[model samples]
Target: MGPSTIPAAVDAAAERFGDTEAVVDGEVRLTYRDLRTRVRQVAAAFAAAGLKTGDRVAICAPNTWHWVVAALGASYAGGILVPLNTRFTAAEMQDVISRSDAAALVVATDFLGRNRLAELEELGGVPEFVLTIEDWAFTDEVDAAPVRADDISDILFTSGTTGRSKGAMSAHRQALAVAAAWADCGAVVTGDRYLVINPFFHSFGYKAGILVCLLTGATLVPQAVFDVARTIELVEQERITILPGPPTIYQTLLAQPGCDTLRLAVTGAAPVPVTLAERMQKRFGTVLTAYGLTEAVVATMCRPDDDAETVSHTSGRATADFEVKIADTGEILLRGPNVMIGYLDDAAATAEAIDADGWLHTGDVGVLDERGYLTITDRLKDMYVSGGFNVYPAEVEQALARLDGVTESAVIGIPDDRMGEVGKAFVVSTRLLSTEDVIEHCRVLLANFKVPRQVEFRAALPRNASGKVLKVVLRKESP
Candidate 1:
């Protein structure tokens, strides 16, 4: 059986994989034993700083050795971790800190060549006990706090559909369960090396990336910033065996060199072109697709035996012991051990999300095939009707992704005199293009209603920190 709580997991890793290298952060190689020792020291530091049980500890930093230690250390000290998005402005950071009521703030001194702490202070977000993530250590003698499996471990905020972020609190057992589920799906094993490209603030990085490594005894290699050249160097130098990210990550890497050494690759946000899936299968021995959200870190995942076409078209069947069902309305509902406790302190919203039947009503709409594989259609909110027929923007966007020179695109519904509502696409391209270039291309791939009625090309699309397109922002823009 796996460890019950996260601290217990760390301790188990020390005993089980003691001499094995746990982390590789550029000249700082730590064995599992050393990792546990550092975690205990940082936990003691948190206690010395007057952190109380159940108190919230907010961390604002990039993915690094410091972020891993600080987050794990906070949990070891009986504190709830609140990881803030590095892309957030000072005001957004202050808002989350106040909302979570974080008692202590651990932040990076500098990132992106800016003084992060200074910006927060300038915006009047001074916490009671502030410390830099780089220097979070103490030698004071203190017994490590005991954490029950039921205890709250972290409050990860997710901004879904509404554009406003909500804190989704998860217990120790739930977090570990989700990570273990993901690890099993990806075939993660001891002695494998994983390069975490996802941000630490998101559940994909924190749970699936970090905790998965801790559970399977894989070495964790963190990259502070994602530069294609730098990432290639890390893969070669560390001999990375596993890589996972969004489809865009693989798309960009396909054009770059030195990624042929990867043994496994995982990606989501589907409608993955069979072409790209085939390319990834050539470079990586195994490519898997998964579907997850903040509430349930991992629900369904394609297996190693799954083919490239299966990985491209579907997110695979449920693997985390999650019960996947389609409501009569076509919305996806999940019930499993990995579901979060609830949205932090929002009883009404929680009630609306999880029914008395114990199923969490996922706002996403999807389809389940005969073999139990799942294919996400689109968000219930994002779906629009054109000429008395329903249209999913993801389908149109998938068609757009296939067009040459069309790098990224987001589609929203616009008011149409004849159809009442029609699709409008905001595209990011590699070369010059006109509206006819996009419309004519879509006419061949999609039906008349599913085609975008108008097109706008921009240098970039507005995205949230988690890398989701801000369709709400696009809806607010003047056509």
Candidate 2:
């Protein structure tokens, strides 16, 4: 209902928790006062670097307080923060930066440089200034001016499974609305320690972890990468109350030798297997299954106070201030203030995604029950045709997840001269699962056409920051 920019919100939190630890990353610990000061310094540096209001600054980093500092500083200086996927190639990075007309970039020193950053330096259309997290130096004189809620705070790119990524411009008001919906209704309390395993380059990580911590005055435990043993230890050591991650993350953490310290485990991005959810609740605590998209930041979250049955089955109820509807085609469309201001610089996509009535067409197909809980069955774009029979990848992947050795699976439609388009599976398993075993498992549940024509086993499947299986990466890696 009101403006909630990063600077204003952090200023409030600093006043309340100045001496308290606001962030912990390995050996580094920053208090609320220290974070506030650094954010202002970065804002001042951006201003000194000749950045103006509404300019875009891309961030390619992991889950560090530096990423938060850069993002919050950009918001404070009235610049649009564009988060670049750390997995992307140099060409991909150049395309996004050039397309967004980014004035500068704050990149990770060694994490994302190996792929294509060196090539980006040689190529034209580079950002005016490139600063790394370790080498960034900022002054004390930053003129913190008031910013309008209508100003675009960040541009998160989500171009779907295919094609180039589109920058989803999110405003200060929308970001705050998402945070408020979660805090007011989803039970994220102040002083709650949120273990952020997801990368800050993603909308899920930015809104769910960083913004939520800032809004609730929660301490942020920023882990650079997801390691089951380390994550569990952090939860026990820090007494982390809120653990937000993906299905794969939950599966791995639950399998860890010792991980019973978490008070609440919140999962999203992919559907959670009912069996895994049950096991988590029976062993650990309640593991709520939530569903959301980059378009809306986070549309639905399974409340922390929900019963085991509710948390295990549905994506829980819509948060306060949002409406979820099941379209005639079983598509999930959302209407809310948390929805983004359409795709950046793409009017046609903006028109297609957000309708005239302000509903966001979330490209996910699912249903809403009598109790108003939503269940995402499949992704509309991930559905493919095989021998005139329609096949949903989620269906096949779900079946694969049930197998004993299968840790993760990704299904895609590869070219098949015989069947036109045949289903192919790339799987990651704890132990090597034979192709015959995977095929037989799928054959038992799905129709012949829906079953994967070929099953390939890998030590680990490619995944994005949100833990969503990277079908594109899988397709590329497949022989």
Give the candidate number with the greatest lDDT.
1
Residue by residue across 1-479, what tens digits does model 1's lDDT show? 88989989988998999898899999989999888888888888889889998999999999998888889888889999999887666766887899899999989988887677898899885788998965655665455588899999999976534435578999999999989998888889999999998888889899999999999999999999877678778888998999886566677777877766688988764356788898888878788988887888888999988888899889999988999999999999999888889998788777887899889988889999999999987666786756434466777788799899999999898866445578999999998899999999887655466789889899999989999999989988946
Q: Which residue pairs in candidate 1 collide?
A: none
lDDT of 2 by residue, 1-479 (tens): 33467668778778877877888887878888888888889888888889899889998877887898999888877788999876655656788898999998888767633523455787777787777887877767575657877788888876544344678888887887787676655466667788988778876678877887777778899888667678778987887777876566667776766556566777654445678777777766656766776788767767656666677678877874789998898889999777888887789888988999998987788888888988777666876656433466876787788999787888998766444468898888988678898888877655466789898877877779998777778767666
**Number of backbone collisions per candidate:** 0, 0
lDDT of candidates 1 onward, in order: 0.84, 0.76
RMSD (Å) per prediction: 10.3, 10.5
Task: Give TM per candidate.
Answer: 0.80, 0.78
Worst 10 residues of 1 by lDDT: 157-166
User: Candidate 2, 209: how far from true, in Å?
Assistant: 0.5
Error of 2 at 290 (Å): 1.3
Q: What lDDT score goes with residue 417 in model 2?
A: 45
